[model samples]
Target: MAGTTWDIPSGATVKVSIIDSTMRLSNMPTTMLFDNAVEDFDHLDRIPTWCLLVESASGRKAVFDLGAPTDFDTYAPVYNKLMNEAGLRSGFKVEKDVAQVLQDHGVAPADVSSIIWRSEGLPVSVHSSHQHLDHIGNPNTFPKSTEIVVGQGFTKAYCPGYPTNPDSPVCETYFADRTLREINFEPGPAANPKIGGFRAHDFFGDGSFYLLDTPGHTTGHLSALARTTHGDIEDTFILMGGDVCHHGGELRPSPYQSLPDPLTASHYPVPAGLNITGCPGAALFGALQTSRGRRARDEPFVDPSKQLQEDYAASGRSIREAQVPDAMDNVFFVFAHDATLLGVVDVFPKGANEWRDKGWADTARWTFLKDFAPAAAKFGEEK
Candidate 1:
């Protein structure tokens, strides 16, 4: 976890924006998050596959995740089947593709210079946060000239994707003939000890963007940290937390911040009847008998160390510590699936670089806690 810190030059700025693919889907509770309960609520919950657009000061532009695809059938059969079983097979339509979203913002697929996974290519490359279908967003949809980037160990883990593997979730053509650069996080002796508990590589080499080695969700999952503002020594940053923590609640309520009561929380428009005046942290769902229900104290939970999906809870804890409240305006954690950000921050064409002024971090801080309102009301008082 040791790595050197890269310094951002003063006055250098990166234009950042949240691009809405407008792709939405209804999912069972435990599908997006591990320990949640769907049967406890009356209906299913939905979230958007939000993407990011980061443009460097020198005019180099790159896109983060591609969000969901308009023509999802183009993806591998294995992915299609999984989405089908997960109830996410049909909600996707073409109009919300990442290409369309970029065009709407006056940028075209041909104009982009790089495709950084999890985060860009030329006018340079297309990068994936990991190999997940939603994160990759049908990379073949991008211009063929654009290079594809991934985190360390990607090729060895999933190189001959799809068709070849039959059950592979990625398409083989995505990496075929493309400049697929896998990020090697091995830092030299001069590098610092660590960058937020993970190895990091200064992506631009100029200190503006850093590719972090945050594995857990998948074999090669990666996250990006961008310096939003330059200061004397330490600068402010926007942590593009790919799939590290799907929900805000998964990372909030650290030592630096606590859950906001109904009256103080401003981001979410609390309904007329539900009043969690003094709500504590996230509301916990009572024990149920579902296939993935919580195990009793006597029963053993899955050892995170051995899970093939990586250490989700450990990743959540790392992100939580990085975005603590007192950590100053220096850090803003943007998990890919945090629905609370839908209206809090402006979308593409309107950059989220103004997040500090807009108080977006504080606004959306405790909004996720509201999701448990109904469950809390039905159960006893907040714990």
Candidate 2:
């Protein structure tokens, strides 16, 4: 668990940049994401989609997660129906697709060597983190030479997509005339080794990037870890957590990184007239703990939605394992829909390799706690 360490070799590093997908899902019910037993908040005001551009030292480029398609109508009829049934039609909005965003940034689609999601290549290959519509994007936009990479069970689960499997969430056109490569993480003579409690494949074999087997959100959910700076006193990494947890509350306050005591204004701006300068961390956030067990303080504020998760227990383990690197100063964890990072971090066309030197982690770490302002205010009033 918390004691686990990553054995990242010292070698070539990659340049990573965040891409604002211009996709926004607003006014989503909080209950749809996690249990709202404590009733801290009613709705998630804004959910922004974030994608990443990874470039190896050798000039090979890859895009991680395409966010959402510009047009919602382009989705499979079944997926559209599901969204309508879930009453999410009005909430979903995308102003531009990933391809368009890339073009706007001066990076042509054809020049991108790979697009890793659940899939990865130059001529461009698309990797999908999972079969979710938001991440799959519109692979058809890329040249047919662009391959498609996916996780282990993806082919059997949703292949021959759409009309071929009427209920499929993906489109058959995505895989049409494209090379579909599925990553195998099983142990064998040439199998990928374990890195920090995860089965990892060295994508470039130069220690620049790795694709981790992290299932639970879906059948073939994948996450990536990129070495941004190496051959230094301490190597810095950016863990591209693909929906490991939607909100920061679900990943923070682990045993390794407990809530700061004597909570300060810098970490969280206390609402005015609280009549208190500083408060004990436990006392203020105690009620917000969804778990009543002994390790409630060490556990997350909220759990993953069972309805959306394929395996509830596995998802919990994945999140807990992620807490280890997250507590480290050298690792910066960014998930797909973290709105807290909207304007805080530099977006695409700007390299995120200097995150460590820029102190982005320290600034972004406690910002997520602002969402719990209401709970803190209530605690202050009671005090």
Candidate 3:
């Protein structure tokens, strides 16, 4: 774990609030997104899309990843047709847009300095993690002065969207009449420093926030690291992992954070007649490891399948790189669609800056194992 440590520069801290974007997808096939050959979960039900409200110390506010629009019709016709064909139309629903969620919390849409789709910065801008429909939201709701920010190569890949390109999944209206700024992660005077194996840009020109160039999910997929608390000896961070991997299982149990020896019933409750105390982590969930042949104790439960990823190999690399931060005790990694945090962490109206103090990381870490309870029960019975 020596080389895995993050050399974080001491600096200002930001206020982070987890926003329940109100987007939900139930009964989604696990196989559609992940390779679940080892972990046998049929459907990834109650999938929630999470956005973040990041406020810099200077009072500049930014919303990261707007979730989906309340109206599915807001998306491009091609995407809608694809959803209908895939039978995903019924499973998807959104009660409110991110803008409305902010308003309910007393934050006005106009007051939002920027909307980070997947990247982060000051001034009025919208930064998208990728051009995916669920993360794009409705940019039109914000004032035109609020520019849209995206990761590097975003415009080149999906610009002139929809009707203009006919096959584009993005809508041209997202960029119309607004300044569409794409991040340049190239190393130079702008300071694209290497942080945890990814080229990161200091969004605030301070160490408070960094937009990591985490590609693989898409052409310009991005992830973020927010310095929530600064201390003399250590700093706490919240990693806004935007679709790095849909499930926590895909990013956990790395060489740094292996499965706990005695997987307790509190975290992973088993059926009656099984071990009332607890079960050995490896014995209960060993088969869940996706690594072939000689399985390592630290291998993940699953890996992102090639079906949804634009670059499968790159995604694998990014996921591996992400494990470093995920394994750290001071870093709390939250995925965009981690339903495990539904009632676990405070959302929106409550700031998540104190995640460390509340021990949210340890509480939510193994909670994802609940998804494998059925499999664990079956394994216990066979013994």
Segments in model 1 whose C-alpha atoms lie over 4 Å from true places: 1-11, 36-44, 91-94, 119-132, 189-193, 231-234, 260-268, 272-308, 312-327, 379-383
Q: After superposition, how far is residue 77 of candidate 3 from its true place, in Å?
A: 1.5
What's each prediction's clash count?
34, 12, 11
Models 1 onward score TM values of 0.79, 0.90, 0.91
Question: Residue 86 of candidate 2: its Cα lDDT?
Answer: 59
Q: Rank the candidates by lDDT, best first.
A: 3, 2, 1
Alpha-carbon RMSD, each predicted model: 6.9, 4.6, 4.5
Worst 10 residues of 1 by lDDT: 121-130
| Pick by lDDT: 1 or 3, better one | 3
Give one digit per residue, the lDDT tens place, for model 1 in 1-383. Answer: 11223333333568788888776655433433444433344333557767888888787887877776777787777666665664555544435778777887689887766666662210000132112456677677678777777877777766577788876666788878777888888878323224656777776656677777776666667787777876675566788887766665445444444333333335445445775554322223222111335332112111222222455665555455444422445577787777888778888888887687788887776676456455544454523
Per-residue lDDT of candidate 2, residues 1-383 (tens digit): 23536676665799999999888888877777776423456777668878999888888888888877877777777767766665666777888888888898898888776667642100011122112456777777677766666777777776677788776667788778778778888866233777788888777778788888887777777888999987446788999888788888888788878776655667755545544556435556754553233244566677777765676787888898888888888889988888878777999889899998887888788677766766665655766
Worst 10 residues of 2 by lDDT: 120-129
